[model samples]
Target: MKKKLGMFAGLVLFVVLMAACAADSSQEESDSGDSNSSGSEDSSAENQDTTEISFIHWRGEDEEVFDDIIGQFEEENPGISVQMNTYPSEQYQSNAQQMLRDGSTGDVFTSFPGTQFETINNAGFFTDLSDEEFVNNFAETSLEVGQSEGSQLAVPYQMVFNMPVYNKGMFEELGIEVPTSWSEYQAMAETLKENDITPIAFPGADIGPNQMMNSMMMNNAKNEDIFAQLESGEETLTNDWWINTLEDFQHFNENGYLQEDALGTNQDSAMQMVADEEAAMLATGSYHMASLKELNSDLELGFLPPITVSEEEVEYEGIHTATFMLAVNKNSEKKEEAKAFIEFLSQPDIASQYANETGQHLTVNDVDYESESLQNTSHWIDEKDTRFQPRYLIKEAAVEDAVLGSIENVLGGTSPEEAADEAQQVVEENID
Candidate 1:
C-alpha cells in the first residue's frame, strides 16, 4: 500500500512540471511576436520622418506669422519640415521670373496672376495642382486666377482692392460726405484743396500711382471691354470711354489735386503725403491700413472708392485680387509634402491668423479676421459692387506700356487726348 501511494505522488509531480514547461514556451512566442510588431512600426515611423518641403514667398508684414503657422503645421505632421524663403517686395517679380527661367528655384514659390504667370505656366515651370483638393476649397473668383486652361499653376491666397482710404476725422472736420460718383470725387477734391489740404496725394515717381489712376479711370468707363480688344490689337482705343477716362486722369493732374513731385515720387513717399496730413485722401489697398494705423492709431481711416456713374451703383467685373500666389516647382523632389504645406495654409484658422497679423485680407471663404479696417473695406466693396481692377483686366506688360507708362506723359503736361493717342499706338504695336 505505501509503494502504490508514493508512485501516485510521483505521477502527479511529473504532470505539474509538464504543464509549467508548456506555459513558458507559449509566453516566449507571444513576446517574440510583440517585438516583431513594434520593430515594424518603428521602421514605418522613421520612413515618414524623411519627408521635407521648401517654401518661398515675397516679404511683407506677414513673414513672422507665416513662419509661426508653418512651425505649427510641421508639428501636426511629424514627418514634414518646412523651409521658408522670402524676397524683398520691390524685387519679387524679377527675382521670381529669373528663378522660373532657371528651373532651380525652391520647391514652392510665388507668382502673380497675369500674362507673366500665364507665360510661366505655359512654359511648364510650375507644378499643375488642378486636381488637388485644396484647389476646390477657394472661392470661384479666387480660384480663377490660378487656373490656366485646365491646369492650376498656383494657389490663390488672398484678394486685395485698390480702394480709396480717407481720414475720417479730416472728412468730418471738413463736413464732407464720402463721394459716390466721379463728379462728387472731383468736387470733394476741390473742397479739400479749398481747405488748404491737397485733395488727392498721389506720387507718380513710381509706376504705382499711374497704375492706380489708370485702373480707376477704366473702372468708371462706359466701354470696359475695350481693354481686352485693345490688348489683342483687334480694337483701337477709339472708344469714347477710353478718351473720357484719360481726360479724367488729366483733370486730376491739371487741377493740382495730386502732389507736385508725383512724377518723381514712388508710392511710399506719396503715402507720406497722407501720413503728414498734406493730403485729405489717398487711393490705396486695404493692406495700407496697418501702416496707416502704425503712423497714427487714432487717425480715423475709412474707404471711399466707388464704381458708379451716379450716386446709384453700376455693374462691376474685375479681378481685384492680391495677384500673389503660391506655386510648386515642377522639378521638386518633395512635391507632395510641399502641396500639403499649401493645404495647411488654406485652413481658415491659419488664413485668419495670417491676415490679422499682417493686416491683409485673405481669400479664405467665410473666414473673418480681427481687423475692423478689413471688415469695413470689404463691406464697402460689397456695397459698391466693386470688382477687380480694370488694369488687371489685361496682361501686365501691355497695361504697363499702353496705360501705365503713357500716364506719365499726361502728368507731365501733355493733353489727355494726345496721351490717349500715344497709348493707343502702344496697344497697336502689341496687337497681332
Candidate 2:
C-alpha cells in the first residue's frame, strides 16, 4: 500500500484518538472565519478594533490541534483573532484561488506556490516581505521557494521529500543492506522477488501518486536543465537523459516487481502494501513517517535516492522543501497582526509543538529533530546545498509541474522522449 502525509494518516487507523481528545479548549475555539461582511452598506461605518486573520487549509483530524495552537496565540495577544478557514482537500486549491481573487477571503493562507506563485505574487496579492526579520530564521531553501523577483512572498511552514522507505526488519531477515547504486538496487529487487515478495509498490492511478515516479526520473536523470532549454525554444525533450530514465522505469514495470494492479492502485492501498509486508520498499516523503508509526510504530523506514545513470555523477539528494508555507496578504488591513502571528509560529516552542502534534517536519533551525531519518535527511540537504547543481534542483515550480505532467505521460505508455517533447511544447506555449 502507498502512504499518506501528516497526522491524520496515522490517527485514522486507531479510530479512537478522536473521541478522547474532543474536549480540549484550545482546539475547539479556533474559528473558521469565512463569514463575509454584511451587505447593503452599513448605515454607518463602524470602528473595528480587533484584527481578524483568515487562512484556508485542508481538512483533517489535526485541525483541532491547529485551532488549539491558534487559540493560545490569541490569548497571549489580545485584540487579534485567527479565522482558520478550511475546505475539503479536493476543493482546496480551487477555493483558495477564488478566495484569493475575491479580495475578502483569507488575509493569510497556505499554498504550494511552485508554478502559480509567480502569477499570484505578480498580481500584487501577497506582500513583499524580503526585509522582514523572520525571513532570516527560515532555512535558505524554504525561503527560496517563496521568493519572487528578489522579494519574499511567503513563509514555508513544512518540509517534505520524496525517497525510498524500506522495511528494515524484512531486509535484515534477507541479510541485505540498503542498496546504494543502480546495480545494487536491481539485484536487491531480484532477490526480493526470488523470495516471493513484491520488491516495491507503486500507485500510478492518480496524478499525485504518479508524480513520485516522475520526480524520481527528473532527479536521477538530471533533467534540471531541460526546463530552461525547452522554455528558450532551443531544445526538445528527445534528449538522451530523459529517454534513458523512461526506459529504466519501463524495465522496472515489466519485471513483475511492482505491486499487482499497480496502474489501478491508489495511495492508501499502496501504502498498505508496505505496512502489510507484501512489499519491502515504497517511495514517499518524510511526512509518511508519522502515518507509518500509527500502523506499526515499530516498522523501520529508510530513504534511498532515486537511481541514476548520468555520466556526471550527480549528487543523490532526494527532492524536498519546507511544506506548504504561510503568506500574509499585502493588501490586508491587518498586516501588523498577521506579521506578529508569523513570528509567533516560528518561535522554537511553537514549531516544536507543531512537529510533535502533527508529525510533520518543519524547516526551522530552532527545533532539534527527534527522528533519526529526519536528522540524516537534514545532513544530506546540507551537503546538497553546498554543491548547488541546477540539474535536479527544480528552481521553479512551473518547471516542476510541467515535469510532473510529462512524467505522467511516460508512465501512461508515452515514451520518455515523447513526454519530454510534449512538456517542452507546453513550456514554450505557456511559460513566458
The numbered model that scores best in TM-score is 1
State model 1's lDDT.
0.69
Cα error, residue 56 of model 1, in Å, equals: 1.8
Please give, for residues 1-432, the per-residue lDDT of candidate 1 as tens digits.
899999999999999999999988766643322222234667645644345565667855667888899889988997776667788765776666666554334677878766657667767878889888887666665677777777777877877766667788889988998775767877788898888898766756654553365345645563556667777766665466766666666777788777776677777776777878888767666667788777767667776653335645445522256567888888666678788888888888888888888877777666676877776666543454555556656774765567766667777888777888888877777766
Indicate the TM-score of model 2: 0.79
Which ranges of candidate 2 are over 4 A from the true structure? Answer: 1-49, 59-61, 88-90, 207-210, 218-220, 310-312, 371-378, 383-432
Stretches of candidate 1 exceeding 4 Å from the true structure = 1-49, 101-104, 222-224, 306-308, 317-319, 380-383, 396-399
**TM-score (C-alpha) between model 1 and the true structure:** 0.81
Q: Residue 21 of candidate 1: its Cα lDDT?
A: 96
- In model 2, which range of ten residues has the least summed lDDT? 38-47
The local lDDT score (0 to 100) that residue 155 gets in candidate 1 is 78
lDDT of each: 0.69, 0.65
